[model samples]
Target: MEGFLQLLLNGTALGSIYALIALGYTMVYGILRLINFAHGDIVMVGAYAGLFTALAVNGPAHPDLFHFFIVLLAAMAVSALLGLFIERFAYRPLRNFPRLNLLITAVGVSLLLENLGQVVFGATPRVFPDIMPSMNWFQFGQVAITNQQVTVFGTSLFLMVVLEWIVLKTKLGRAMRAVSYSHEIASLVGIPTDKIISFTFAVGSALAAAAGILVCISYPKVDPLMGVMIGLKAFVAAVLGGIGSIRGAVVGGFLMGIAESMVVGYGSSTYRDALAFAILILILLFKPAGLFGKYQPEKV
Candidate 1:
């Protein structure tokens, strides 16, 4: 029972990180209906930002929260701006083209970003600084958890809350909804569809950046390929939650995280990934729209 509880808490923490990254995937999908395969690579770039942050401040420079926040902001800002640029340069021209063209472009962008990261950040693994102290908040029975886990879970939840509020309340959120539901109608109603799309990418990228930072804290390693599994897992989370549903993203993220953790806990950790996909396959076959997604009639 104690072991089960430990697994649960650990899974919840993992799920929170997945949820954060999955939110980015779902948000972009909701607005543009574009997969943005490069989205994961953006997370990788953010990790590089954080690694540099750790080196600069916590390394020889002496540690400070101000410096930490600056690095975090820089990472997020760079990612958001890059997302905006990708939408403009790579996707805008193909907006009127077939969805396949856009899909191929997304794959291209993903590859480009991955390779660019490899070239710039190098293939070497980098270590992140110890931001959280090793104090346990409280012990439940025989289980133990550190401040880092609490920080990761807490920060991810806070971001999720802020995003959910923005989407459900703000005027810009309404405009985004309008554009997403039907671009032609949104534009007819005087909404700037192009701008809305750009904003969506920026918001999604920022979320991905935060996820990157949090994952770094959890795993304490950063490399060019770091975002691959997280990105794939996040994409699965988005699919499980109904690709366009924001609430679904959060639900799917936490669920997938727990599921994956349980697999690792009970079985060979090497098969952990396969277990995740096996579950995803079951979900796809049984409920194609996912837990939070709705089944829409195909339009001819």
Candidate 2:
């Protein structure tokens, strides 16, 4: 029982990170119907941004709360700008073209970002500065909980709540939902569809940035390619929960994380990565629309 509880706690922390990243995927897809494959790379970019900011502010040592906030904000800001740039330059012109074109362009942009990351950040992995002070917060029998896990889970939940508020309560969120429902209708209704789309990308990218930092806090490693596997898994989580459903993304992410943790604890770590793809396949076969996704009939 203690062992089970331990795995559950660890899974929840990891899942929250995946949830953060998956939210970006779901939000963009909900609004634009574009996968924005480059979204994952934005995580890498954000990690690098946070790393540099941390170094600039406190060198290699752990950061105080204020400095940590600064580092987080810097990463979010940089990633948000990059998201805007991608939407403006890479996606805008091709918007009216076939979706296949946009898809291909997204892939191209993803590759470009990965290669550029390799070139800019170098292929070598860098140690992410410890921004949050580490200590055990609680322990029971054989189960233990650390400050890092609490921070990751707490921070992620807070951000998710904020995002929920923005989507459901804010004027910008209303406009976003309107645009997501129907771009042509939203534009006709005097909503700035373009601006809304750009904002969606920005917000999603910022969340991804937060996820990147949270991952670094726990794992303490940064690399240009680090986002690849994690990003794929998050994408699976989005799909599993229902690609366009916010609630679904969160549920799917936790499920994926928990599943991974259970497998690692009770089974072999060798199959950990394969678990995501397996879940994807099962979800696709049994419920293509996902646990929270509703199917919409195409108008002919």
Per-residue alpha-carbon lDDT of model 1 for 185-287, expressed as tens digits?
9999999999999998998888899888888878888889888888989889888887889899998998989888888888779987786688679889999
Flag regions of model 1 displaced more than 4 Å: 59-68
lDDT of 2 by residue, 1-300 (tens): 999999999999999999999999999999878888998999999999999999898845755667778888999999999999999999999988999999999999999999999998899999998888877899899999988899889989999999999999999999999999999999999999999999999999999999999999989999999888889999999999999999999999999999999999999999999999999999999999999999888897
Alpha-carbon lDDT, every model = 0.84, 0.93
Question: Using TM-score as the measure, which candidate wins?
Answer: 2
Candidate whose lDDT is highest: 2
Local lDDT at 210 for model 1: 84
Candidate 2 Cα outliers beyond 4 Å, as residue runs = 59-62
Q: Would you estimate the TM-scores of all the predictions?
A: 0.95, 0.98
